[model samples]
Target: MEAWIRLSIFVAVLALMLVWEAKRPKRSGRVNRWHRWRSHLGLIVTSSVLMRLVVPLGLTGIALWASEHDWGAFNQFELPLWLAVMVSMIALDLVLYWQHRLFHRVPWLWRLHRVHHADPDFDVTTGVRFHPIEMILSLAIKAATILILGVPATAVLIFEIILNACSLFNHGNVQLPTKLEAGVRKVLITQELHRIHHSSVKRETNSNYGFSVVWWDWLFGSYTDQSRAGSDNVDIGLREFREEQRNTPFWTLLLLPFKDK
Candidate 1:
C-alpha cells in the first residue's frame, strides 16, 4: 500500500512536470528526449533493482521497524501526531542538506556524485540520473537517519513523496514568471536555481546542493543568486566530459567513478 502510494505520486508528478516542461520550457533544444529518457530510465531501473534485491522493504520499512522497536529521537515524545510529522519533515531535510554537501566535499564520493552532474543537459529526466552506488548510499544514510530520528512512518511516506516530486520539478526545464520564481524560491527550490547547480562552472556546481528545498543553501551561504555567465548562457555538464557520449552510455556511468578522465 505504501509502495503504491509513492509510485502513484511519483508517476503523477513526473507526468505533470514533463508536460509543463514541454509547454513552457526555459530552453528549447534539439536533443532527443526519447534517447535521454532511455538512458535516465535505465539508470533508475538499475538502482531500483539493486534496492529490491538488497533492501527489499526500503526506507519506509526501516522507519516502520524503528517505530515498532521504539528507536530514534522523536519516539520519546507523546506529542500530537501532526506536530511530529511536521517537525520530522524539517529535521530530515536539514540532514539531507548536509548529506548533499558531503557528496561534493568528499573526493571519492564526488566520483559517484559526478555521474549526476555529467549530464550534458538540464531537464526533468536529469533529475533521476544518479549512479546506482549513490542511490544505495543515499538509502543507507536515509535509513540511519530515520532510525535515529524515530520519525513516524507516515511522515516518512510524506517526506519521500515530497522529495521525489520536488526533485523532478526543480530539475525540470520549465520556465516560470520572474516574480513567482523569486517568491517561490524563497520557500521551495525553483528550476532556475537548480540549473545553476548543473552548470559546468566549478563554483556554481558546488553551490545549490539542495534538491528538496532551498533554505539550506541560503542558510549555509552556498546560495548564488544567478549563474555568473547568466542562466541562459551557462554551460551545462562537467568540463572533463566534453564528449557527450561520456554521459550517454549506461556502462560508462556504471564505471565512471573508477575510470581515468
Candidate 2:
C-alpha cells in the first residue's frame, strides 16, 4: 500500500510536469528530448529496482521496525503523535539538506553525484537522474536517520512523497509567473533557484542545494539569488560534460565516478 501510494504520486507529478514543460518551458530545448528522457527515465527505473531489491522493507518499513523494537529516540520517550510526525519530517529534511551539501563538498561523493549534474539540460527528468550507487547511498543515509530518530511510518511516507514531488516541481523547465515565483520561492525552492543550481558555472552550481525548502540554503549561506549570466541564459549541466552522447548514456553514468574527467 505504501509503495503504491508513492508510485501513484510519482507518476502523477511526473506526467503533470512533462505536460507543463511542453506547454510553458522556461528555456529553449538544448538537447534531444527523447534522448535525454530515455536516459533519465532509465536511471530512475534502474535505481528504483535496485533499491527495492537492496532494502525491500523501505524507509517506512524501517521506521515500523524501529517502533516495534523501541529502537530510536522518539520511541524511547513519549510525544504526541502529531508532534512526533512533524518533528520527524523536519529532522529528516534537515539531515537530507546536509547530506546534499556533503555530496558536493566531498570529492569522491561528487564523482557519484555529478551524474545528476552532468545532464545537458534542466528538466523534470533531470530531477530523477541520479547514479544508482548514489541512490543506494542515499537510502542508507535515510535508513540510518530513521533508525536513530524513530520516525513514524506515516511521517516517512509523507516526507518521501513530498520530497519526490518537490524534486519534480523545482527541476521543471516550466517557470511560474515572476510575481508568483518570487512569492513561492520564499518558502519552496522554485525553478528560478533550482536552475541556478544546475548552471554549468561552478559557483552557481554549488549553491541552492535544497530540494524542497529554501531555508536550508539561506541558513547555510549557499543561496545564490541570481545567476551571474542571468537565469534565462544560465548554462545548465557540468562544464566538462558538454558531449551529450558521453554524458546521457546509462552505461556512461554508471561508470562516470571512476573516470578522471
Candidate 3:
C-alpha cells in the first residue's frame, strides 16, 4: 500500500513534468528526450527491482522493528508522536545531505554517483537515474538512520514520497517565472538550483547538493545562486560523457558506473 501510493505520486509527477517541460523548457534542444528518457526510465526500473529483491524489509519495517524493540533514540524518549515525527524527518534530511556529499567526494562512490551526473541532459526522468549499487547503499544508510533515530514508519513514508516528488520537480526542465522560482526555492529546491549541480564545470557540479530542502546547502556554504555559465549557456552533464550515444540505451547506463572516464 505504501509502495503503491509512492508509485502513484511518481507517475503523476513524471507526467506533469513531461507536459510542463514541453511547454516551458529551461534549455533549448539540450536533450534527446526520447533516447534519454528510455535510458533514465530503464535505470529507475532496474534500481527499483534490485532494491525490492535485495532490501525487502524497507524503512517502514525497520521502523516497526526498532519501535517494538525500543531500539532507538525516539523510542527511548517520552516525546509526543508529532514531535518525534517532525524531528525525525528533519534529521533524516540532514543525513541525506551528507550522504550525497560523501558520494561526490569519495572516489569509489563517485564512480557510481557520476553515472547520474553523466547524463547529457536534465529532466524529470533524470531524477530517477541512479545505479543499483548506489540505491542499495542509500537504502542501507537510510535504514540505519531510521533505526538510530527511531523515525516512525509514517514519517519515513512521507519523507520517501516527498523526496521522490521533489526530485522530479527539481530535475524537470520546466521553467518557472523568475519571481515564482525565487520564492519557491526559499523552501524547496527549484530546478534552477539543481541544474547547477549538473553543470559541466567542476565548481558548479560540486555546489547545490541539496535534493529536497535547500537549507543544507545554504547552511553548509555550498549554496550556489546560479550556474557559473549563464542558464542558457550552462553545459549540462559531466565533462567526460561527451559522446552523445552513451546515454541512449538501457544497457549503456547499467555499465556506465564501471566504465573508465
Candidate 4:
C-alpha cells in the first residue's frame, strides 16, 4: 500500500515537472540542458526505489536484532496509539529540523549534503536527489529514534508519508497567490519559502530548512520570509563543487564525502 502511494506520487510529480519546464519562460536566455535534466530524473527514480526498500529493511533488521536480545523497549511503551503517532511525528520532525540545520552549519557534513545542493536547477526531482550515503545516515537516525523513543512502526509509516508528500509539494514548481502563500507559510513550508533555500546566495540557501512544518525554522531563527530571485534569475549549485562533479554517477556521488573535491 505504501509502495503504491509512493509510485503514484512520483508519477504525479513527474507530470508536474514536465508542465513547469514547458511553461517556464525562455527570456532568461539560459538553455534547458536536456541531458542533465534527464540524468537528474533518472537519479530521482533510482534513489526513490533504493531508499524505499533500504530504509524499511534497515529499520526492521534493527528491530529484529534488538528483539532477539530481549530489548523489547518499543513493545514496552504503553502509550495510546493516537498519542504514539502524534508524539512520534513531532519528535521526528524536531530531530530532522536540527539535523538539517546542522548539515549546513557544519562544513564536514555539508560536503556530503552538497550533492543535493549542486543541482543547477530546482524542481520536484531535486527533492529526491539526496546521496545514497545520506539516506543511509538518515536511516541510522531513524533507528536511533525508534530505540530511544519507542516509536511505533505505524507512526514511522505515517511520518514517512507526510515527509515525502511535503517534500514533493515544496520542491514542485506550482505557484500560489500571495495572500494564500502567506497564510500557508505560517503553518507549513511552501514552495516560495523552500525555493529561497536553493538560491545562489549562501544566506538565502541556509534559511527555511524545515522539511514539512515551518514552525521549526521560526523557532530556531532560520526563517526567511522574503521571496527569492525568480527561478530563472536564481542561481543553483554549490560554489565548492566543480561543474563536472555535478553530473557524477551514483557511485561517485556516494563516495563524494570522502573525496577531496
Which candidate should be chosen as best, given lDDT against the real structure?
2
* Ranked candidates, highest lDDT first: 2, 3, 1, 4
Better of 1 and 2 by TM-score: 2
Native-referenced Cα lDDT, model 1: 0.86
Going through the candidates in order, what is the number of backbone clashes in each?
A: 1, 0, 0, 0
Candidate 2 positional error at 195, Å: 0.5
Better of 3 and 4 by TM-score: 3
lDDT per residue as tens, model 2, 64-160: 9999999899998989999999999999999999999999999999999999898888999989999999999999999999999899999999999
- Output the TM-score of candidate 3: 0.96
Q: Indicate whether candidate 2 or candidate 4 has the larger TM-score.
A: 2
* lDDT score of residue 125 within candidate 3: 83
Q: In order, what lDDT does every prediction score?
A: 0.86, 0.91, 0.86, 0.71
What's model 2's TM-score? 0.98
Give one digit per residue, the lDDT tens place, for model 1 in 46-147: 998998787888778988898898898788888788998999899889988888889999999999989888888789989899999999998888888899
* lDDT over C-alpha atoms for residue 163 of model 4: 84
RMSD of 4: 3.7
* Clashing residue pairs for model 1: 73-149
